[model samples]
Target: MNGVELVCPAGSLPALRAAVDNGADAVYLGFRDGTNARNFPGLNFDQRGAREGIRYAHERGAKVLLALNTYPQPQTWSRWTRAVDQAAELGVDALILADAGLMRYAARTHPGLRLHLSVQGSATSAEAIAFYREQFGIQRVVLPRVLSAQQVRRVVAQTDVEVEVFAFGSLCVMVEGRCYLSSYVTGESPNTCGACSPARAVQWSEGAAGREVRLNGVLIDVFGAHEPAGYPVLCKGRFRVEGRLGYAMEEPTSLSVLDILPELLEMGVSAIKVEGRQRSPAYVAQVTRVLRQALDACHADPAGFAPREEWVAALQRVAEGHTHTLGALERQWQ
Candidate 1:
């Protein structure tokens, strides 16, 4: 196996620096608006901050990919277009985008700027990827976390474009860019507003039994006295079904593909992306460090590769609900 690019998330300037300092090959981030996903309070960069981050990453031999990965309504189209211009002006290594109109504008207006299809595009098939590559000149596609490794290998075999896959962090059970559970509850979603389970609508209440988590005043989950509490995202919460209470849609767990590093490398994946821009700088640093070490180990001896116990422990310490899953990389998840 050869060296696979390690792309880390940077929700803030500090996170950007931490990723670069911790041996990330590239750092992808979003602006402080609806143009990108992970639009959370006190996170994401502004124009000036993004420019500084690009400079910082370049100085450290790391590339920065600016994410304008959200869809835009008719009224918001100009803002997304202007964001593309601003990203090019700031010297971003590439623009990660999802909207076709925005991609067309970027490709036609600034032909030299590299384009990457965000996972939000949800292009799982070679035909869909081919259309983007031909129409908008997307150089790479970030595959959604919905395919098994064998399926991913098939996609790679069918496409000439570079492929990137999520390797770690929170898992979105719903298909990227199509989830409406948050919007149904809060009138906001990642596709339009670049957020799910918006902080404003979240509420936690302690009770005699334990705790209750709610989203937009709707009861999502109730925790036992000794059970661990999690975020009130509608999908990951436990609910009543058939007179029994349990995780109905999905559980509160993160995706960790550390064990499949060799398989990804062998499949000729161009990059492995870490997906936590809403998390803190410490989280970014620790995750990047562990992934960096794992990547190095795999590249050194692919056949002998194995996940380190310490690496797993380190990631679990920061994982949501203190649990992780193989996600769709394994057939069982499908």
Candidate 2:
């Protein structure tokens, strides 16, 4: 257990500023292309923006990690390699990457540059992490959201590499790097095109009874007159199972680990990541502010730490479906 670094997401320059200003120890961002997972339109950074963001973060005594975390096809592999070069040239503190080929390129070409295994790499076990560290000298690994706190501790104890876990924001129900649900509907996925539930394939319509959300003409979910609506990601939608109608995979809920800050800190996690690169600067500010307060409180008194009501309320305001869960951190949630 040590002082946990608060790593926040910065999809844009303004979001990066918001995260740093709100007390982030480090900020992670992606290039404005298919190289990063959050390659949504109007999000992420261009070359100039990435340079400016790194300068801003460094000036403020915060670190910047560039994400080249997508799986690139053979035809598009050069783009990913070029992005690694760009990140190294930009003086990023580290590069979060998932592709083995690109990882090798970065490690071999820029021996001094730090490499972090992206969650999309799906390295949950100690052996998987050790392999990456041995083969490519990966300094850190962002664990997928499917592991429990105990499982996380086991992985950490077994590896010499630093471990980073998601603390807040949207939850992906499926295992990272293997999810094909979005691809099945939109013909694109985070593993390939760098986005699941791409905006271009999403459609919303009003029907006589209620509202409807469709992804590539496939019905994702339907909302009643007064029910809340959510993004049409395939996993978060409703489905019928055994003649019962409900969310078959998972509901549209954000992950909030404020209550378990002490457990994570005690587990010796290197960093606590906030997962919202596609969010606005305002969202970044609010989330960072709350988590900053909580983490500070936990560091001051881990044994007696309690989540503040105001912090929970503030996070819930921006939570998807107006609900938050511990994700797989709590055994029951798994």
Candidate 3:
């Protein structure tokens, strides 16, 4: 199988360089503002940084995808439009967008700029994808992490656009870009604010035997002495289901598709995406390197490349539960 392009994450200029140097075919990133999805403190590029990053990645024959993927308020159209303009001015390889108006603006204003449909729009069906392709000229699409490889193959056979699927990093059990757990508690929406469970709202209260993980003062989870606590998002927690208190939506885990590279390639995907932009540069470099190596191997012998246990060990250092799953890629969902 011809393995798909390796599209990795770059939360900072240094991370961008690391991803490229470590063997990424393309790196996806965002500006510091709400224009991108992974808006976190001390992460993301400023305007100047993005320009330099584009140059840095392009010089190495790797592409840079600028994520303008957030939905805009009626009054905040200006911010979104300006970001699109800036990405075009900086000569980014593509703009990953969600809003229809923003996509139209990009196509009309920056005609030469390439358009990619972000998963925020929830373009799951072939019909939905075609709508964007016909209307806004989106050449590529970041498919939501909700399709089986078989379902993905069906979508690809039906649409004319290039498909990008997430291969590694945080698994969002809630619907992609449509979660409201943060807003219900903190008044900040991921879709509009480009943040989910904002960092400032997270708090940990120590108890005699353990700690309570709270979000905006609401107790979402309680960690026992033996249990470890993460950043305390509303989702990805142990909750009650039918009187049993355990992980309901999903457990804290990362999605790993290293073993399924050949299947994804056989299904005709265009690129593989790694999802952790909130993570460190070291995490980015290591994951990119392993996937790049796997991809290189798969191009030679499709069935011969099985991801080593060491690669999984390397990934588990940053994986949410110290475990990984094939997730929707293997149809492991309802």
Best-performing candidate as measured by lDDT: 2
lDDT score of model 1? 0.92
TM-score of each: 0.97, 0.98, 0.96
- Please give the range of 10 consecutive residues that has the lowest summed lDDT in model 2: 1-10
On TM-score, the stronger of 2 and 3 is 2
Q: Flag clash pairs in model 1.
A: none
lDDT of 2 by residue, 1-334 (tens): 3488999999999999999999999999999999999999899999999989999999999999998889989998888889999889999999999989889999999999999999999999999998899999999999999999899999888888999999999999988998988898889999998999899999999977689899999988889988978778889898899999899999989999998899998988999999999999999999999999999999999999999899999999999887999999899998
Name the better of 1 and 3 by lDDT.
Answer: 1
Q: Candidate 1 — which residues are off by over 4 angstroms? A: none
Compose the digit string of candidate 3's lDDT tens values, residues 241-293.
78999877778888988878888887788999998788888989999988888
Residue lDDT tens for model 1, 44-99: 99988988899999999999999998999998789999999999999999999998
Give the lDDT of residue 305 in candidate 1.
Answer: 98
Instruction: For candidate 2, give the lDDT.
Output: 0.93
| Cα lDDT for residue 103, candidate 1 | 92
